[model samples]
Target: MEEESWQSITVMEDKNGEPHVLQQKVKVYTSGVSEESPGYTKPLMKHRIVPVKDIVNL
Candidate 1:
């Protein structure tokens, strides 16, 4: 497998189990492609990644 262009620095979840993307002060990877555009593998969420803790709680 190839290395991911970007990775989740940190992820935080809300009480409702909804992911709260902390986009400030954190580094997110970008291939410079818009999500609406084609061939975009990046997630459209505001956060880089969601931790397993969030899923378990939710």
Candidate 2:
């Protein structure tokens, strides 16, 4: 089965020129004999959205 883990993220940006997390999804899989193959358990997901209030020039 596939190992349960979090997805790696370096940087995330939104359409309003803001950094945020929206509709985060993760895949949970059942254990298998090998790492190559794994079974899915269910579709687990989440959602979030944020807007930039101000922009600062650096």
lDDT of 1: 0.46
Candidate 2 — what's its lDDT? 0.48
Instruction: For candidate 2, write residues 1-58 as lDDT tens digits.
Output: 4544433333468665666433334566866666666566444564344332332234
Looking at model 1, which ten-residue stretch has the lowest summed lDDT? 1-10
The digit string of per-residue lDDT tens for model 1 on 1-58 reads 1123443455667788866544323233444555444342444434444545543565
Q: Positional deviation of 27 in candidate 1, in angstroms?
A: 12
lDDT of 2 at 51: 32
Colliding pairs, model 1: none
lDDT of 2 at 35: 62
